[model samples]
Target: MVKEVNSQELSQILSNDKGRVVVDFYSTECPPCEALAPLLIELESLYSNDFSVYKINRQDNRELALELNVRSSPTLLFFDKSHEAGTRLSGTITVQQLIGAVVDAFQVEARTLIVPDAHENIWDVLILGAGPAGLAAAVYTARAGKKTLVLKGKAKSHLELAHLVENYPGLPPLSGKELLQNMETQAQGFGATIEMGDALDLTFGHDMKLVTTRTNVYKAKTIILAMGKGQHQQTIENEERLIGLGVSYCATCDGAFYRGKKVVVYGNDEEAMDDALMLKQLDCDVSFVSYCKSTQCSETLHESAKKKGIVYYPDARVTSLSGQATLESITIETEAGTKTLEAEAVFIIQSVPSKSLLRKTGINVESKDCIAIDKELRTNLPGIFAAGDITCGGLQVAVAVGEGVSSALSALKYLRQNS
Candidate 1:
């Protein structure tokens, strides 16, 4: 069990001059911190003797948090013999990442606590998204008695954000939230499980498809792509070439790799702001490049960032990325003039098309980055279907629902024949 410690107790523990220590500075009402709690509990259960684990409420212990430079919730600090050890991990972290941090901090090997094989939970139909297309597909598949599962990403669906949805059939005009709630209710009533998490990676076998998230893995006999459009893809030079080399879309997944390095984040959403704060906690030279107007960001975030002394570039856009083999600098177009900023890494967070997931499965996508699907909503790969905005179908809710039903029928047929 992880013990809750105040600043005084924490300072005393850190200065004990014995035993490896792991301190977690967390906050209430923080989703990422909530998600990290279970993993931390499991870690303590597995390595109680190797290290001592403690938790501190950042909100209650403001002075200690400031002194320790814990600017983000769920900031983890490792210590060895009264000295800091290893790099701190902030934001959402996977089990593998946690283990790696422990090894780096204490030189202790993980004997147990292995991640269960993703292939363990093999559903008849595994939907890659939980948008209109995915939820619609689940309604059909679950009614047909096929084990259906939908992986809902952290990013809210475009439809969910819409203020009103007027044209969905068999329903009166209602708010987007209401329409989605009805769909979710219908899907769940039919015995479908809608799990919330992002699909971090996907792999295909001859008969099975494997999907990985930060905390869990899933398997499906048939897969459906209803992930909607990609809105994050910016048309910057050398962006594609530097994907793993430097350019990243997820700060939580890649921020640790650039500890104490120069990094630039381009976006105006909550996720982008959170990423910027996380990088700052890791001692990275962080800069915020907001494409939105100055008033767009929340006052809390804007003020907190300013207080942290993070550089801000409002109303700016990245025009190009320059590097030989890896990213070296980024050129931004601001109101003042075009300027190049020296950056070791660039993180662009936005919504774009879901083309990369399609490409990974060897599925063909059109020139406009839309997945190609037949009238039946089936892709080139057997037992795999595409629907919703991802297929370049009309962006209307009614159209996505129709395509979702069609794809579900096609998937049902494929499953019956294979069985």
Candidate 2:
């Protein structure tokens, strides 16, 4: 069983424990801490006789947390007798990583990888976005017998929202939705795998690239950036200054940090609603502020919120975020008027900011903020390419598809040469 310990109690247990022990330094308003709670409990059950699990609330015991150098919530420190042992883990802890840590700490039980094996395999081509350009690139690469994976974001693609598209050469006047479906079908038919998750982070390298999503990590030989311009650009005031201090883009990643504390969810998408609900489960005082109307969201989401008694401030936008050492509150401008919300954290749930992601990969961009791509649609960096509106090319579907093909061929060439 998992035991909640104070500073003195934790010290006593650690000093007396003959076997291995794992200490989880958690905070009250921390979603990561909440996420780790059940996992640690399960681990306790798995090694009932070999190890012990103890969780101490860092907020309630600040000196102990500081002494342990626990700068973040959900920090797992393994102990052998009274001395700290093994590697410590903090932030966005994965099951596979946790399992490895357990083996290193306790060497207890023969463990199997909990997630699918495919997530660990390297891909020949990895495409970002599920729009026409990305799908077209996937179709080409997958048809060329290259292992391909495409990740789509929570926000519907700009192409997916079109009412009708008729300018293309072949097909009749079809809905944008239908055209996109056909493209996805073609890519899948060519053996390309498509999954739904925003590209949260990108790590570029000489031979391989690492892309982290909400759930999985993927490695690829070549990366295709076809997400186009993002709808969210981190516009709120003081948002950047307080990134780690309080304002977070990912709910599941940072929600545990705000567990049982007042926080606000800002966005009009279904993802925002889903995150707000998750916060409620963490016992957070969650208030949702949708940029659109109450009627704009699904009835199911509305009903769910009503049932949960979660307050909603529709047709609202946060003008600014305010805090010093940590986030304190947010200023919202609703249809009614301006109001201030006392919040420990604010979750901006939207598509991952493309510009920010691009900057991290060191991709060159012109003054137009469009990617600098060669005629072959290859970016300045090797093994990286851009397509569609992101390249500041023609916005039409045909132009996007043509660029997509060009980029795919370039990526295939890069892979062949590298291999």
What are the lDDT figures for the candidates, one per model? Answer: 0.79, 0.81
Worst 10-residue lDDT window, candidate 2: 110-119
Using TM-score, give the best candidate's number: 2
Residue-wise lDDT of candidate 1 within 1-419, one digit each (tens)? 78999999999998875889999998764545655666688788899889989999886887898798776667899999989999898655546567878999999996555332342567999997888899999999999999999988766878888897777777778999888888999999999999976665555443556665545656678888898874445488888777656787667656765668899998886678888998898799998888877574645557767988788888789989999877899999999999999998888776423554444456788877888899899888777899998888898888888889999999999998987
TM-score of every model? 0.63, 0.70
Candidate 1, residue 405: CA error in Å? 1.3
Q: Per-residue CA lDDT of candidate 2, range 238-346, in tens?
A: 8878775778777876777666899999878677788899999989999988886657474556666788867888778899988898899999998789999999998
Candidate 2 regions with alpha-carbon error over 4 angstroms: 1-119, 170-174, 292-299, 306-309, 324-326
